[model samples]
Target: MTKFASLKSVRLAGAAAIALLAGAAQAQNSPPGAEMATEAYLRAIQEKNPVLHAVIAVNPHAKADARALDAERKAGKIRSPLHGAPILLKDNIESNDGTATTAGSLALKDNVPGRDAPLVKRLTDAGLVILGKTNLSEWANIRSNHSISGWSAVGGTVRNPYVLDRSACGSSSGSGAAVAAGLAHLAIGTETDGSITCPAAINGLVGLKPTVGLVSRTHIVPISHSQDTAGPMTTTVEDAAKVLTIIAGSDPADPATNDADAHKTDYAKGLSKDALKGVKLAVARFYTGYSPKTDAVFENALKDLRAQGAILVDVKDFDEAPIGKAEGLVLNTELKADMAAYLASTDPTKVKTRTLADLIAFNAAEPKEMVWFGQETFEKAEKTKGLSDPDYLKALADSKRLAGPEGIDRILKETGAAAIIAPTTGPAWTIDPLNGDNYGGSSTTLPAVAGYPHLTVPMGDVTGLPVGLSFIGPAWSEKLLLNLGYAYEQATHHRKPPAFRPTVAP
Candidate 1:
């Protein structure tokens, strides 16, 4: 029997128990008002974060930032809806706040960035409080193929709030768990492939993997420039839209975002319960069938979509042969080139390891970081010929073309659909130290590699664990995806706060 099935016997009573516990927890931890005061949120972080291991460091100036925003609001100079809202950031993203931007690795424990990343500046300018930096898989899960998703030497392992022993699904694990556990109003998570959406899905939150370049990646730790972007992870789709609007704009330092201002808008204004009306959505069933419980949840979501006035068209699968074969080559080649550039930009005094080679050597010298997994992926990336190689060029062209124009774009054009829907991923698995992540099915790759927009919303729970339904579209289709996600979220109201269970009891 499958894991989902094995847990079904205890699901009904377990869910009720979880709900009661969650309600009590929330009541005990509730803030003074509708919007949590930044001080109260920080106190909660201090009380709850040790057990959760979600936050790596608390921003020493967060209380002051929140007070400043409150003063602006009282002065009738409110910058945006996010004004005074507490926000957590993934550790890989740099901030001018006193905390170091460690990618959960000890080598950069003192890598305190002098300036905020462009995206961080945009959000702070709009008045969001930088609560703290959250933990992530060391080096964004690129150091080792067998690495634990939420384990890092700096922050230890991030525990799932729903079930403490289960995987939180990195490298956005801490961001997802923090928001779900109400440690903050919102959090920023960076994705390359399933990093953002997978964690969001497993943790029962809304996550958007915006089109690459829509959000500036300047100053973030690099994996692949072709596929990396920071996005919002929130308990509500409306909150995700609000955060996205603030961060989506042109950045002079990042040339890829030169045209971003044209595509940017107040995404929150586009949300409506009737937004799904007259919309044609295609069902991408390719990612289903991994877990029966997940598929069941997805099927019910389709029904909810149809009830919301959406026309659902069935598209079994898209041809993804070329994308799978060339993706590794593109990522490996870019990692060597992009990481060197990012490291070069860091303060030499704060960062001792200056390049990919330097990082590999540092890991070898410090064996504690590799106690659970070897640096096989890093070794492979180090051996790759730099970006100028013919192999790298061919792989990049093939992967992008197939994942974009010939894959997601073709399906939308041929099927006359505005967006496609699929299961974001299966439920969170047991975190195994002996092996690595036992990821089941996932639908993030096509949109991730194609540089398209993908949003995951809480669909339902399977044996007391959360699952997410994904909406994907062509580049710059974030508005459409958010609207659809908002509509579905309203109709179903599937999200439930985590109960912080020890495990799935039988």
Candidate 2:
């Protein structure tokens, strides 16, 4: 059996990577050579990642890759605006950089496929350096309902950068924390529901969970094919837009992305501070009032939008109970099928857990895997019938319908709004391993199940823990959502770097 190395032990590899870059010769100062910038980022990760537990493994080849990119830059062949920028990927995203793409699961510690996921390929082709893999909730937080967010057996618990003892939120916990702490220029995070948005909001960054098919899901660890997608988690909305433009294209391997090329555009170019002028936005009243403090922050955010000459309409009558029930069945059914498919695609010798059942048995025998939480959710997924089962098919259809045309679109038509706005989620909660995550209100479900684009920008802080304001639109409306978010972000710059305090006072 392959044993996963400790996160502390992994730091040694990152240290060696920095050491390798220390010898790179042809360094430039104009906009900084890729090698120079990569070395600085590696140093920051080496210094801060130990405390934050945000990085799973640093790309040992990063400096070499940076050197190559610098050579290209010297040849006057720039790739994109993000040329030479170092970006971190959530651990689930595969790359051929020698680091294993563990979903923070010991079962996949040796699952180094030596191939880049389609999105990673796009990033590297555009001259972005693959910095490292960020830790995530084990199996993207689907192991159990009682499982703790940001806690993984392989990488330990990812500490929130703002209030170290609070939840960073996952399974994009490390990506959010890493970028918030300035460990990377940008990070890629995948979301099924609130993974990207919650973490980015709580960590004081911008998170975009694009429409389901807008980005390729090939080679990623799977939960549900219907809802999974990789998106940008960055400190600025423009950075998110820049990343989206590069990664949003059709992948032959992913049939869902067949229409992606048609919808893809230069998202960053569409951003303008005047994008919101005269635009009417539907306020998702249904998603507010979870936290009084969060509501207060949201009210101020609305005022900011109003000050920008925008009309806000309150949309209060939306029920999520049926959608929640339907989504549960759909996710469970897809998990059993999709996990098996992803496992089969892995190197058989390296990954022995080839099926959901195998994973369940492996977890039962692995003491550390169960130390923080049980695999009750896995058990539930295992019991689910195949995808062709009528119950599951019905659930999938109903979920998409109720959350899409009948939900978000209906609200938009009735309110005459360009997009819907709400509090992304409440502030970070205290990290309680024994009790698990106490998540508050979230506006992730409607857009998530609907396969619509959702963007979360830093709104403000509550007791020093940051929160985000959400901008949601119909499917393939990523460009519109990004522009709206950019406008708001410019009008009220609420994002700030984390203080890294041990805890926040009540």
Candidate 3:
């Protein structure tokens, strides 16, 4: 659950981490006389304010890495910040070692790969140890509209660390819950849209939705080539920056990058404590004025920012989301094609159903999957032609024009600000098995559709269920946003772990 190697790599890539090591040369830097051992990390989990074993302990090797990290720290030769950090990746991502890479379905339960995903490689190269894979919504939560967030056939349902009765949110559900519960310091999460941020927001952690190509999607399972991305989910902006610096890079395997004008770098430099000083920003009040309780929290946050000298501008003109409709069309057209292609690349000899149509048939044969939620999204997708379809081509064109030029670009140009801020989402509602998520306000659809980077920080709490405040900007604005988020996090210090109550009595 910890990202020790990434923690160490923070210094490896940034000025601060190395400086710490430089000043304290020949001395163990984990903590002042800290015990670096498998026992300590396990004890941390054992004594977690809220237990998080279900999401992480299934990975058998997590303990071994903890021991190694402890040994290295004792020897005064820690590999990186995330070296001994126990990290649980979503099951969809490939793990070269012993961890299984099932995408939350029994179908791919044994679909282990021969190599670690490119993102995993970057993390490990930076000294991150792969503890094991955490559970997720089956197939990245793309199956059913009625599908509960965080419920996977393989992992069952991931309960919110705060209130167990509430939905943990989906796809990256385990990552958010595990990190918030102190099972690990950080986790790597993927998102086509709300997967990462939703879980993180509701779990009281930071979620970064990197620009489409900021991190590699080479070995992870896919939904849309246009929107699929991997990012850091952590307790603090500093921690997210620590891991992001390593994973943000160009990858040849993911050709969508050829057209991407993304800014990839060690984004941790933006973690300055005073980043909000005199920084110009716009608040999309449209994303606000949702929940009365959330409004109170947002106003308080605004007061804090104003006091901190963030030149705030009120923006009410943006109901426009770039590539808005185009994004949906793009996903539908791209999914069938991209998924089929990806399925073909896997170890076909072992896979039962490769095509989306095959999956539909399997679901029909097994009533449990199709009883309530059906793959209507998949059926719609399967009916569409390849990326060459005139509709898809137009949608792609519309996406660029709207989400990029008319959307984020226009806003930045009008405000002349470094970034835009809004309510990431409203309060977490009661989890309903008979129904799906009770989402209130969501600001993810904009930057998410534009293929731009977005970072959401836990601004404050709402009725005890965590709600996040979102900050977004043009591509590669990760550093600027990170600095702002870090400054706010340090200023408010709002993050708190969940209490795991069975339910919140309304």
Q: Write the per-residue lDDT of candidate 3 for residues 440-506, one digit (tens) a residue.
A: 6678877878888899999889778888888899987788888899899888989875666666786
Residue 464 CA displacement from its true place in model 3, Å: 1.1
TM-score of each: 0.93, 0.94, 0.89
Better of 1 and 2 by lDDT: 2
Best by lDDT: 2
Q: Which has the better lDDT: candidate 2, or candidate 3?
A: 2
Q: What is the C-alpha lDDT of each candidate?
A: 0.86, 0.89, 0.74
For all predictions, the C-alpha RMSD in Å is 6.0, 5.3, 5.5
111-174: candidate 1 lDDT, tens digit per residue: 9998899999998898788989999999899988889999898998998988888999999999
Best by TM-score: 2
Model 1 spans with C-alpha error above 4 angstroms = 1-36
Clashes of each: 0, 0, 26
lDDT of 3 at 272: 78
Off by over 4 Å in 3: 1-57, 69-78, 257-262, 321-323
By lDDT: ranked, best first: 2, 1, 3
Model 3 RMSD vs true structure:
5.5
